[model samples]
Target: MLLSKASLEAACGRKTIRAAVPSLVSPFQLTVRSLPKQQTERRLVPMRRSKAVSVQNNFSILALDDDPIMISTLQAYFQRSGYHVDIENDPYRAIERIRKTHYDILLLDFLMTPICGDQVVEEIRKFNKELFIILLTGHKSMAPPIRTIRELDIQGYYEKSDRFDQLELLVESCAKSIRQMRTIHSYQNGLSAIVDALPAVYQLQSLEQLGGTLLETAAGLLHASSGYLFLKQSDETPAMHPQKDPELFCTFECTITKEQARAQYTATVFPDQKTIVQQNKMSAPLFDTRHSMIGMLHLVLPHAPQYEQVQLLDIFSRQAVVAVHNIQLHGLVRSKNNELTQVLGKLRDSYVDIVSVVRLMVDARDIYTRGHSDRVSKFSRRIAETMKLDRETCERVSLGGLFHDIGKIGVPDYILLKPDKLTFEEYNVIKRHPDEGADILAATSFFRDIVEIVRQHHERVDGKGYPRGLTGDKIFVEAKIITVADCFDAMVSDRQYRKGLGVSAAVHQLQQGRGTQFMPEAVDAFLSLLDKEHGKEVLSLYDTLPSTI
Candidate 1:
């Protein structure tokens, strides 16, 4: 049915009256400002006025009516009722204006020439589902079906009448609903930002570093003024190792007394579950995937968080547990590695004692050299120290002296025990001892550095000595020190064939042999060691030979 001008005004209950328009032009397709003067001295009911005024001032209302006189009247009436209102006479142009402006309530006319209010609301819903809408009609017959109202998602409906009290009530009701939706959107945005930032905080490796960043970020995101992060202490004592224990930390905007913080800590259960407890203050427990408690966070905010926010904090707490566990694993691996290294050192020391016992058994075969190996070992160590050699080289030189004659165990008893002069074949058998000793020591990994010293101790600077006959620099520095110490001990010690050369004669022989048979530096160091305070004590200690077996 075609609607007339009178019929449209009858729907709105207004005449063809014009009010003075505002001088400014709005950027939207249609803009209706409040009239210069109010048209109705009538006020909303006292009960409605009190309720409407509370939220009416914050909302904006837009009306879509084809009658110009009806649009002007609504502009004046709604504005006087403490709402920001705009009106559109062209229903087609109203869509564009609504799209361009921000309105809390859209009051759409039910009857129009080309388009109805329900169709316009359906069109508006395509672009904006959040807009609160109300349908205005002249009669119930003109309104769409109940299904159509539900489909369009309209908030309320009002019949155009002289009172306009119902229309005012509709506008105020829609405003309250709009406020709730906006609050929900704000919370969703805040939650999305927290989820996005959590991965970066989880990337921290250090427990202290992760704890500090995590608590500060959680407190700020939760709108908390103060927070305490309490991680459980491990059973192990921190003083036994270098690493310190992880402590309870707090991130706060205000000062909290130590007594109060201690009280809060004591109140938390020993093993807390993933739950939030609220009484005078708010507390939440952090748990891992297994639901084991790792820590707890205490917060002080102006307002308490919703259930959804507590769920988010629980998620962050789980991530914190994983990070802490990773740090603990790293520390455990390092401690185990250090303990393994110390145990290996003790094992090596025990092996050295076994090698000394073997050397003593070989010396027993030749009673004249009962303490020969021990004396040579002491002399080699002292000479190495005087030369300022590194400790490892000195130790190898000393150990090599103990094992130098181990190959004599392989020689036949007849040749080794003969007091008479040896034949050329027997002397050649003696010269093979150095080579055999090196071969025996080479089989063991612990004697790697000592291998060269044992092999070349018979080598001479003049290249006239035995085994490989290695010359001057070809022999290792450690081998040279052992060579000088061995020669000095062998010369001064008694032999099975003749009496021993005394200290004076042995010193003179070493001096003459320097740079020819012995390394000049090694000889000089050995001679200097003999002049020290302990030289006489060391010589007297090995002066006697143990009785032959």
Candidate 2:
């Protein structure tokens, strides 16, 4: 259904109706200036004369209807109110335009040829859910059911009248809503970009990679056409020079040379602590962990950015500071690591000889305990290997096992070598060896990583055994492995006070102690090892060792 002739006459005076363009003329060809002087006089009325709609320059509208006059009136009124407006008489053409172009609000007529407004809305809802739509009907009764409107997400509906006061109010409400939605959408996108860019930034190992990643992420977030990143050369040196000039490290579609960026950094960005925006360009200072200026970032955006974009850029700049500082710290760590590696190489032989002498001294003091540390170290390493632990962990566990009983050196000879069963006081004295061993190893940086294992090797899974009553996962896995190996060897190896529990008895003890005194996984791995052919050989080797005092 098209606009009635009487309604058209009422909208524009009769003389203006006679001047209307031919229906065959395309709607796109019509403009406000082409309308008759009297037709243009019929302007849309505002809901409140003093409080008119405030439209943004980019806020736009698409008016779709079968009647040319109705489309013309809407276009003229919206354009006059400072909005960008387009009109389409064919629903198919309107739908195609909506698909290709972004319009903030759509003004749709309820009646049209071939298909109605509801059908057109259904087709559009298939692809675009964000477009704000308003249905215009000749009468309230002609409007689609409320259910259809809700399912299609139609934002508003209005009865067509001689004056467009109600329609104007609805458009104002939609414009405000669109502004908020766009702001939220932009914020979400900016946060997601920051999240995605940080992993790439931190993964970079070199200063060059760091600079490029920081520049790319900042530029992409700001939608800048080009940018330059300048970082301090002194960050690579052992001692930093705060006043030194920064070198340009990266450029993205940038025409400026290094000298130009350096000049801008010194003249424009260095003195100002706040971000500076001039027309289409922005300059933000890069800071270190101490909040000292370490560099500058310059970007050429497509237009002067909004307050929200500036805020997001500020956030990105703070994270970039962390990235830059991490890169500097990494460089220092790499240099120090090289020096330490060389020093450790020189001390390697001497360090081994000293540990060997200590082991011999501990064994020489007790005939029954001879070869005990070596056996424990080998057994612990085998358990670690059976558990598929890393090479470094296996090595650490072996070292830990070797030194696990070093604390017993501090015990009195009468107590350590006593052939009689230990009273409660002597047993209490025995419990202190783990702590003493941890202290001895902690004195050397070489044994730093294994100190916890040495300290907790006697700890029980049920929190019953120990220098410290650590339970379950609180015990280091390396410590747990050593605990299982140490307990097994102590149970099966001879001591002066009693006959050694034979291999079968020791296995029974281990099975009884599972979960109550030992980590279940460690026990399982060690038990699996004992079942192997090599494990039988290890047991035989233990049997061949001297058992006499």
lDDT of each: 0.70, 0.77
Q: Give the Cα-based TM-score of candidate 2 against the true structure.
A: 0.54
lDDT of 2 by residue, 40-135 (tens): 335433322334454546788999988787788788777777789999989999999999999888898878877888899899999999888888
TM per candidate comes to 0.50, 0.54
Looking at model 1, report the run of 10 residues with the lowest lDDT sum: 18-27
> Residue pairs in steric clash, candidate 1?
none
Shift of residue 223 alpha carbon in model 2, Å = 3.0
State residue 429's C-alpha deviation in candidate 2, in Å: 24
Tens digit per residue, CA lDDT, model 1, 147-207:
7877888776665544565566566556666666666765676578667766766573566
State the weakest 10-residue window (summed lDDT) of model 2: 16-25
- Report RMSD for candidate 2: 11.9
Candidate 1 local lDDT, residue 384: 88
In model 1, the number of clashes is: 0
Which stretches in model 1 have alpha-carbon errors above 4 Å?
Answer: 1-223, 230-291, 301-316, 330-346, 385-452, 462-474, 497-512, 528-542, 546-549
RMSD (CA, Å), each prediction: 12.0, 11.9
Q: Any runs in candidate 2 off by more than 4 Å, and if so which?
A: 2-56, 80-84, 96-102, 140-148, 233-248, 255-263, 267-274, 352-549
